[model samples]
Target: MEQLRVTNQDREHVVEHVKAAYAEGRFDELEFEDRLERAMTARTHGDLMPIMSELYGPRGVPMPRPVPPRATPARMHTGPTESPERLAASAAHGLAAIGFPIVGPLIFLLTGGKTSPYIRQHALEALNFHLTVIGASILLPITVVGVVLLPVIWVAAFVLSIAGAVSALTEGSFRYPMTLRLVK
Candidate 1:
């Protein structure tokens, strides 16, 4: 049995690796819990290195390389460029307007309004379409007889809006369905 050396930095790095692996669903429940426990118990970098090597070695676990940070786009020199968050918001807005308006505005607002203006603009347009559809439906005689459908539409919109909001906050690029491409 060869003893492995660990240093403080190695332990911290190992802990991070283990956490990332677990988050990526590479480990089953038992393995995940066990690995997490081991990572927590790691005291020094040297101690952690060996443990990590063992876990990731043949017949053990496989660890992936850390993801590099994405480069931030430089500020637009002219007009505004779309951000990932904004792209997602735009997508959410389109989905919401198409009878799922619930998620668009929530995503737009929750993203600290820092998302791309393009996304916000698209979402607003979608929202407008959704309102128009609801208005048209309400004015129809058959829709008046089917008043229960009104609540269903509202609920659907609310749910979609919430989803869009969360995605924006998380900086995800979501695409709205059935929306005109107003922004490139």
Candidate 2:
């Protein structure tokens, strides 16, 4: 991990704290002068943190931990697409907007998922997208802001479902944006 450099603002903030601590009678004059010097001389977060910790204990200044980047799975098929496969895949996406959000793609997945990788991929995408919609539909209505956006979500889902079907027919694959992809 890279060491985080402390800025002038950080040093000044530490100096202010030292002054406040001294004003509150938390330390003697000599200790105040030592801390003030240390604050002005701090070059990194590590250098300034110890002073704050000494004044207010460990939890007073939290050292930010480095966060790992998240990786989303990519499910794209580049193989040759067949007409029947395209039709099945197209149906998987089209049926979602026709009121079979969960059941339609689920049937396609169970029937053709094992036999055809292309169909499986499309069915899985459709299934996951519909499941996300279902989850949103159930949960979004609980809040005022969510209630207002619920219809918009439904409309987007409808339009995206149509787009997915069209893409499957033409390009043999389509990924829905903002989908959770829980099924995979």
Candidate 3:
């Protein structure tokens, strides 16, 4: 058959669907990743067919997610609130501050992150932040200036981790400067 060409939107749509499935516990990490890579790289209708088919079994409409009860904040600015999701997010950065390179974010990623987008984003950010720090630590020791900057980097990471934890707890978003997103 002459295949219909796919566009970037088509590929992105498929990827989003796969992510939703993964988030909803329909697919495992390995399976999600394999499907994701294929969806992202698919070239034509033939390429897209199998992915949607496997996920929905020939259904045309995507599965609808249940509506969550909305929480309206009284003010634009809010303080730290105790929640399982927020606690997991705070731990992602707090543990990083204590010098666990991957363990902290890994914990969040494995736990609340699997289902919560909010937690997942924070975990990925923390993981990327520390990965960047570890990479810089290894490469910076070679030069005199780099050696001088090494301790500075550590201090900055320390401060940033605290900031990340606070922001995460308070329903705010925090991003590390110069972080490379290797995980996402």
Candidate 4:
């Protein structure tokens, strides 16, 4: 396999995650500094994997998603988009508001995921986002400040869901910002 290079931005991203884990009390001062150094100097995505695994579980570190080869950009938009696929994709995002984040995305994932790339991508994005939210909800309560961010996260999730639903309605493939691609 080709080596996956990490850029300064990637290292910075990992640094932020390490800082959050520290704020959540996942690491002590010494360990936090050590992790921060490692994240800052990481040369490749693989170098950051163990650092994330230390915060989350082994499965939490997401591998790079392989883009499917397509003959043309038109391949992405040429499929049937107005019927069950569009509605299902929209529902995948909207269901997070009703508390079926994991289930709702999985439903469409199992139903149309194989036949519809659009639905599959949305379901995967929603699934990863909810997983991150749930993980944050659990960790943030450990600190007084994290407790405050929890409600803010809740509102962001709701508003983002509505936005994703709108994008789905417009037949656009939408991805949530700052989302860990764990399911991809």
In order, candidate lDDTs are: 0.55, 0.85, 0.86, 0.82
Ranking by TM-score: 4, 3, 2, 1
Q: TM-score of each candidate?
A: 0.31, 0.57, 0.58, 0.58
Error of 2 at 165 (Å): 0.4
Task: Tell me the spans in candidate 1 whose CA falls farther than 4 Å from its real position.
Answer: 1-115, 118-122, 175-184
The lDDT, on a scale of 0 to 1, for candidate 2 is 0.85
- Put down candidate 1 lDDT per residue, 16-81, tens digits, no spaces: 877776677666678877776777776555445555675586455565645655655554222134
Off by over 4 Å in 3: 1-82
Residue 144 lDDT (model 1)? 60
The alpha-carbon lDDT assigned to residue 62 of candidate 1 equals 68
Provide the clashing-pair count of each candidate structure.
24, 0, 0, 0
- For model 2, give the 10-residue run with minimal summed lDDT: 65-74
At residue 76, candidate 1 shows an lDDT of 29
Worst 10 residues of 3 by lDDT: 73-82
**Model 3 accuracy (lDDT, Cα):** 0.86
Q: Clashes in model 3: which pairs?
A: none
lDDT of 3 at 142: 94
Kindly indicate the candidate among 2 and 4 with the higher TM-score. Answer: 4
